[model samples]
Target: MVRQELVARQLAEQITEHFFHGNGAAEARPLRVLDVGCGQATQVVRLARAGHLVTGLDPDPVTLGAAQGAIGAEPQQVQQRISLLTGEGGDCGRWFGPGTFDVVLCHGVLMYMPEAEPMLASLARVLAPGGMLSVVVRNGDALAMRPGCAGDWGGAIEAFGTDRYTNRLGLPTRADRLEPLTRTLSEIVVPLRRWYGVRVFTDQTPDHVGPPVDGRQLAQLLDAEERAGRTDPYRAVAALLHLVGTRPG
Candidate 1:
């Protein structure tokens, strides 16, 4: 969906901005970033362009190859900033030494795993002290937001009764509340910041809201949405929740 794409882009921008701000770098250096389950490597490309040493790890060779192609055509300097690896999500421990990366991104991939604890632990382990972890997952509280918006109160209630939501593709998707996910970090002794809701207003709109609009308008709208996402009321309805946490130094 257009909204979903916008949310992903916004999240990426937020993460990049925070990283640069925290490091006080004109260009990020000694920066090691891992994108777990980085399908097609879009995030990988963005990080590389930002001058971070990026590694994209995924289980699918085909997807990894596609990502490689995507990154390969960039400026040579950007190309040199990235490395691609093929591996399962939980294999972080085997491939990365302890305290190796400044940032670890595990986005959209957490819902697929039956258990998130191991992956979280592995991510915490690889993160350099004072490093951050960015995670984006389905917003569990928003299960009712869509159905209620569509005037399907009964459907919304039924959906909220369950642990997860089903997509058009018939795949089961689980959502997580901000508190619970932050609590998980606490269990591991990681400190969590406030969560941002992604796609709050956009998700309620029809998939094809209108014909492709002006690029600048689109950008403005995404910026507004992202700003709203960080606040109260609006955040509750976001289709996805983004939480950031840091490993202790």
Candidate 2:
């Protein structure tokens, strides 16, 4: 919840700043948005509800089905704005022409791949000029933070100097450091515009523990995390990195 909320807020801020002249009236203009690896369509549905035309593509049919079910439960108007497809990040080109989407999101999807450039290049090609490409991945530079926080000295030490790690689901995955990722984005012509740290303070929270039930506590927690995600030294060590890039117009 913390990670999702922070990512959504940051993305909204950037999208508004670039496209909506900063006022962020979602109804002002409906942009075409594409969400690759849109697991469960959290962002797809959110953007659709905001009046944007959204296409959610994922390789997993079961996940897409679940997302379809969630979208099905939305109001008729919102449901009308969303389209779900079966595809993967690299498969994006198979379904859309170049410069088709005003916004492209690939969140929590890169870690599954050993490298980032190939998948990133694929997503970038589908982004229209001046479009925003938002990416979220495990922070390779801070790979040790989680284990270190949990007192797993050996795991923490091993996590250093390498992006490969087993996720909470026990799935082997890799992470990305900002420097290399930024360089890759440059090579692909989607230059980095802004980036943020996600789950700065809440990364250590156990996955099973639900969000705070108290409204005030949840707000306070979110505020602290939001502040940390934007601040320097703190954001540098966040467990995840949210990188926003823009295609040259």
| TM-scores for all predictions | 0.87, 0.98
For 26-96, candidate 2 gives per-residue lDDT tens digits of 33599999999998998988899888999998899999989999999999999999999887889888889
- In TM-score terms, candidate 1 sits at 0.87
Task: Summarize candidate 1's per-residue lDDT along 1-249 as a digit string, tens digits.
Answer: 454455456555555566566454455555788889888888788778767898899999999889989987899999999998989768888998988888888988888776567788888888888787888888777788778888998879987756577764569877677777888898876678547777777776664466247889877777777787878898877888878787777
What is candidate 1's CA lDDT for residue 187? Answer: 83
Candidate 2 clash pair list: none
lDDT of each candidate versus the true structure: 0.77, 0.92
Candidate 2 accuracy as lDDT: 0.92
RMSD of 2: 1.0
Q: Return the top candidate by lDDT.
A: 2
